[model samples]
Target: MKPYIFSILFLLITSISVAQTKEVLLKKSFKVDENTILNLDLDNANVHIIESKDDKIHFDYQIIFYNYSRRKINDLLDDTSINTSKNQNQIFLKVKNSLYLGIDIKYKPNFDYKNFNNPINDVYKEYLKKYYKTYRKSENLYKTKDSLIEEINFSIGRDMDNYIKKEIDNFPLKKPLKTDKKIEKNFIIEVPKYVQLKIKALESDIKCDYDILTEFKMDSFKGIFKFKRIDGKNNQITSSNGILETYGIKNSRIQLRDMYKVNIGSISNSKLKLEKTKTKIGEIRKNVSINDSNSKLYLYNFGKNFTKFNLTGDYSEINLYNVKDTNFSMDISGYNTALNMNGTKTSFGASKEKELTKILQKKKKENSPFLGNIEVLLKNGIINIK
Candidate 1:
């Protein structure tokens, strides 16, 4: 027999009788243009959207409220809902939740609204004022603004709890009202095909496989992206730390920027704006072309050959592979560069070179241009074009 088994059963029965139920939080539709820009920004919610043949965007949202003790005036947690606003061709949606330290306050104790001068509250405010006057004067003596706000909130919460407990005879004590940590909503949305999409999510995965005649943009601060395919338009994706996958891609203006890693399958259309904060190529499928800023691009077996690459910024590497009758061109300028290509013609020069009359009475020969070129410019970083 386990200790406190009867007590545990009693507690479970009590909780089951009083646990808050889930309900539909928000349900609304707006007038949308034919080619719309659907923007969704959330703190922490898994967003799942599939393109249907419908004309208007359909949203179905639900939330689970916890830590709410049933009291008088049953409208307790009804004010917390998502906001939807619209402009000309853009529709913005947002849900503020506890993911980013958002507080969920419960009001079970009788509010002292009639009695305005609360002794407990006055004592807490007095202490807060004294501390503010002593330690929080300067504007530029801290590390970050966010840290300052967090510190002030901590001070207020501690002081209030201590003061209220001391005056418990006069002031009623309050139990902390907190939502469950599993507070993300299973958000669902459906929209038309010809629309641009933008989302800002935290700790969620974004999977976009829509291939229509429109542009797509997503700035995921802490989430990852799964890009399957794209049509004949532009696509921009940015992430903090996530893996990206794009398989069937065609003539599109694509920009894949990340602070972590990217994986691609087949990409065409010599318009790739790639920027990676790390100094390594995560993965590439085949014949991928990119106008890159910085990263080590390791070229293995050209999956679908004829990959063109143009590079800029610091400490980049290019590992090249040779095929039959495949001519290549490289325009590299930097302080230190490493090119490791066996059985390949190599050339290098400083952009600040002299003329014939000033130096050797002859100009440096230019190599015949190829379909794929590696043009580089650097100041004090290694340009590894292999």
Candidate 2:
């Protein structure tokens, strides 16, 4: 009887552990106006939204685009297309033209209340005094009356004033009392295993009367896209403007921009039509043995006047278990360029011209456009000019 009882307790503990380790899936959508200057959609897109007690919200979305221009993606990532309050936190990326992407929200909650307690408060007060003394001395040495510098000094002073006021508000005046035991609910939504989504191109049967841009004619356009999955399967879906129906399965959200207009010379008596096709291949896996994870890859192709072109590329990525102190490599190849790096040896290719190469090489060494400390190497080029 004793042995049976012990066995039952062990089984119960195991069941609880298993339940805690399970993953959940969530889906939500926001309405977007089609006629607006920026027509974007998050419908059926896999998005991860998180809310925390720190009075902060976070959104992580995996987005893909179709029939959109690369310039539009660049504008959105540059924050030119969206507006937010001064104190808000925002981040955006155009992984692909047909796929406008971004993660925008307010700052995370403040956990500094812990510093207002007894021992911590004393340490903080001492540090503040030292900081102010050092800063003032440095300002005196500069001795410049430049308005910009003065304005910056004024802002710092105002911030210090606010800090003092906050401290006063948190001052404890009376002994705290223990109230009755009460239940408080806290909720957290873990990041999903997969954000599955699909996007179909909408075609209009009626041809509209429009002026053709002479500078933007093409004989053939071909390219490939690469996608990475954190937990589930990685796949690709392709579509063309001529297709009257929707095409492709997206495991995340899809954001489409406008068609990229190019200068393709004047229209002649002979009628010409442009054709494009994109092929996506298998997932790029890291050779190292590590825990499960996922990533994303983007490709942008802009062509010159009428010409036949062919492009090919491949990518390889390393998986990481502990990103805090681990080093990784991301390799990409296409259009006669290759990027290779470990921690420091990074390179970039922007254009066939020497001037552009120098500019891109400089941008590569700067901070990563993303919020992390990863190094980047960018190589870009154009082809088949008439």
Candidate 3:
């Protein structure tokens, strides 16, 4: 037998002897007033928030792990230590080490939560504190804010890699060559109808099936987010490297970076900033502004109340359908951009002028002026209006 195959078989036999699966469930609830807000921060978990009729907040945390020792399971439970508190109409629920430096913390199987020289949990906490401190003081720095955040993210990645490798070397003989390990977490939060939500997550899927309250705020990195109805007055979302799908957004301010896919069912009175994203909108109501860079945008339909639209993009593609039926006056300014209005192709920047401007009018009723106004500024892109 080959040496590699023999080693694999040996490891499998060893795993079969000690492999075990376990599940943990934790539930908590708290009462609140009419003006309460739920502030949540977590990482690496599937989180679902449902609207409740009662005047309270309910949290259900579930965890499952396969092929993990009892000691490791205990560590995981400790790492997931949820902190819940209430202060003056504000409720806070924080997951201490939700991801704990990524799932399946296989390194240092016998990790000691009480005493350890280089435990990942401790290192993570310390570095996170430093990172936030740096962020708070970034306004005074010469470097841009985004650059500073990127630098800190890179630093954390490098430091964690080094620490994990160093810890793995300590148990070289006892560490299994191949361990079938998996950890899954599902968290559900039930809140009252009047409560608002503020969430910050990392690599976690966030879903809300019902209508939200008066406010909603989200900041996430690399996750999938879906909300059925966002009936709120103040809403803000900041996400990157993720997928977002939402519907019925009354008002919102959204910033997307490098998103894989985004879909908005119906949105009105909103501001959007996009970077390297692919986005589709079902219908657009009135008073919306969009700034895009290196993105692909699709607008399928327009609402009858759409009164104002302002769009600016560079190196982007925008397609608007069913424009002939809408009552709007469009002012298009393009530089090095292609325009295909009802299959009549036109190129800007071909003439001696730096830019080209065109006006289009579509009246819903005869002798009646356009009900809405649209302004577009684009460069190095394509605009399709049909």
**Candidate numbers sorted by TM-score from highest down:** 3, 1, 2
Write down the lDDT that model 3 would get.
Answer: 0.71
The positional error of residue 45 in candidate 3, measured at the CA in angstroms, is 2.3
Full-model lDDT, candidate 2: 0.24
Q: Which candidate would rank higher by lDDT, 2 or 3?
A: 3
Residue-level lDDT of model 2, residues 205-263, one tens digit each, is: 11101121111111111111111211212322222322111111222112111111111
Off by over 4 Å in 1: 1-33, 62-80, 87-89, 100-185, 201-204, 232-243, 248-258, 268-294, 299-308, 321-334, 341-371, 376-386
TM-score of each: 0.52, 0.16, 0.70
Please say which candidate is ahead in lDDT: 1 or 3.
Answer: 3
Worst 10 residues of 3 by lDDT: 149-158
- Taking the tens digit of each residue's C-alpha lDDT, what string does model 3 give over 90-203? 999877554652443434343335556645445446545664565446422233223432332222122343244444455434343244365655677898878888999888
Q: Taking the tens digit of each residue's C-alpha lDDT, what string does model 1 give over 210-265?
A: 65456666666655445546544566655665544444455555555554544444
* Cα lDDT listed for each candidate: 0.49, 0.24, 0.71
lDDT for residue 3 in candidate 3, whole number 0-100: 98
